[model samples]
Target: MQDILYNLMSTEFENPWKTIRSRPIYDNPWIAVREEDVLKPNGAPGIYGVVSFKNKAIGIVPVDSEGYTYLVGQFRYTLNEYSWEIPEGGGPMNEAPLETAKRELEEETGLHAATWSELGRIHTSNSVTDEEGFLFLATDLTPGPSNPEDTEQLIIKRVSLKDAVAMVMRGEITDSLSIAGLLKAFMIVSSY
Candidate 1:
C-alpha cells in the first residue's frame, strides 16, 4: 500500500490533449470564448470550446463576533433567478485576491474585516471556463455604508453561520462560490 501510494504520488502526468488550431469565437469585456481543434487523450480528433475570464473570482464570508455571517441577495441576470450568496466579485489578474475580497465584502455588504484567512481556492467551471476563485473567511468585522456598483441592486442579510450552513444543505444557497465558501467556513469555525 505504501509503495503504491508512493508511486502514485511520484507519478508525473503529461498533457494528453493536443491543440491543432484555435480561433476566437466571441469576446466581451468580461470573457472571451475560443474554439480549438484538438486531439483528445485517446488520440481522437475533436473540438473544444473554452471561455477565458479576464479576472479571477474572489469570494468572502464575513462573520461577525456573534458567529453571524452576511449574505448578499441579487437577481442574477444569466441565471435568470434570484440568488443569495456570500460577498463576491471579480478581481483583475494583476491584483491580489485578498484585496479583491476585501473590496467585494465592503462593496456588497459594507463590512470590513480586521482578520482575514484564506478558506480555499476553486476552479469555478473547469470543463469549459478557465475561471479560478479565491475564497476567504473575514472576521472581526466593522460595518458601514455600502457602495455597490451601478449594475448591482443588492439586498443584504445577516444570518448565523449555522443558518448559513443550513442554507447550503437545503440548497437555498446555490451560487458555487457561496456553497464552497460557506461550507468551508462552517467546517473551520466548528473545528474551533
Candidate 2:
C-alpha cells in the first residue's frame, strides 16, 4: 500500500503544451472544434481531437416503491432503434444536475421521487469528448403524469433489478450513463 501511494505521487499529471492554430476549426450544433497541437506525454507533437458541447446531462436510477427499477423505452436518433435506458435529461445549462435529473424523471416517466442523492459525476467519452455526466439515485417514488415532448414516444416500464442487469449484459440496453448508474445503484442496494 505504501509503495502504491508513493507511485501515485511520483506520476506526473501535467500534459506537455503545444501551439494552437488560434482559430475555430469547425462549428456545429453538438460541438465546435478548435485546431490545437498537443504534445504527448512522451514529448511527441500532434493534433488532438477536441470536442466542445454545451454540457453533459444527468441520469437517474429510479427505484419504485415496489423495489423495481424504472426504465424508459425510446428510439435513439443516433442508434435508430428502440432500446431500454434509464431516464436522463437536462444539463447544467438548464438547471442543476440534480434538478435536471428530477425534471427528466418526471417528464419522461412521470415518477416523482421524495428523496434523491447524487451518486457522483461521470466524464463521458473523455478521450475526444468534453461532456460531464451526472448520476443520481431516486427513491420513494410516486406515479405522476408524463409529459413527453412531441418528438419523444416514451414508454415507462418497471423491471426487476436482476433482470435489469441481465438486460444490460445482453446488450438490450446501451446507454452509457444509464448502465453506469444502474450498476452503481444495484451495488448499493444489493449490499443490504
Candidate 3:
C-alpha cells in the first residue's frame, strides 16, 4: 500500500498551471509583488498576483524551566490593532533560520535560550503570499533587557505554557506564526 500510494503520488503530481508572462507589480525591502499571466489547469487564460517575501518569518517560543513561556505584544501597523504573538521577526533569506530565530527571540522578548529545536515550518498565507514562517522551541531561558527595534513599542508577558495554548484556542492570539508555534510547542511539551 505504501509503494502504491507513493507511485500514485509521485506520478500524479505535476504542475498544470503555466505562466505566460510575469511582471513586477511592486517591490519594497520586505516584499515584492508580481502579476503573472497564466494558463489555468483547464487551459484557460487567467491572471495571478503573488507576493514574494524577501525574508523568512522566524518565530520563537521560549519555554522556561518553570513551564512558563513569553509573549510579545505590539501594535501591528498592517492590522491597525494590538497583537500578542510569539517573538517573531523577518530574517534575510541568506541567513540561517535558527540564528534568525535566536536573534528575534532576544530582541523582542529579552530572553535567550541555551537550547533550540525546530518546531516546524509553515506557509503564513499561501493563497496570496509566498511568505514562509519558521517556528522554534527555545528552552533553558536566561532573562535580560530586550532591545527592540526603534519602530517597536513592545510589552512582554510571561504565562504558563498551558495558558499560552489557551490563549491560542480562545483566539486571543491571531498571528499565524504564534498560533503555529504555540500549538506545536504545546504538543511537544505535553509529551514530556
Highest TM-score model number = 1
User: Best by lDDT, which number?
Assistant: 1
The TM-score of predicted model 2 comes to 0.88
Give the per-residue lDDT digits (tens) of candidate 3, residues 9-39: 7885779999999999999998999999999
Scored by lDDT, model 3 comes in at 0.95
Question: Of 1 and 3, which scores higher on TM-score?
Answer: 1
Clashing pairs in 2: none
lDDT, model 2, position 91: 67
State the local distance difference test value for candidate 1.
0.96
TM-score of each: 0.95, 0.88, 0.94
Q: What residue runs in model 3 are displaced by over 4 Å at the alpha carbon?
A: 1-12
Error of 2 at 72 (Å): 1.1
Ranking 1 against 2 by lDDT, winner: 1
Sorted by TM-score (best first), the order is 1, 3, 2
Candidate 2 regions exceeding 4 Å error are: 1-12, 17-19, 28-30
In model 3, what lDDT does residue 120 have?
A: 90
Q: What C-alpha lDDT does candidate 2 achieve relative to the native structure?
A: 0.83
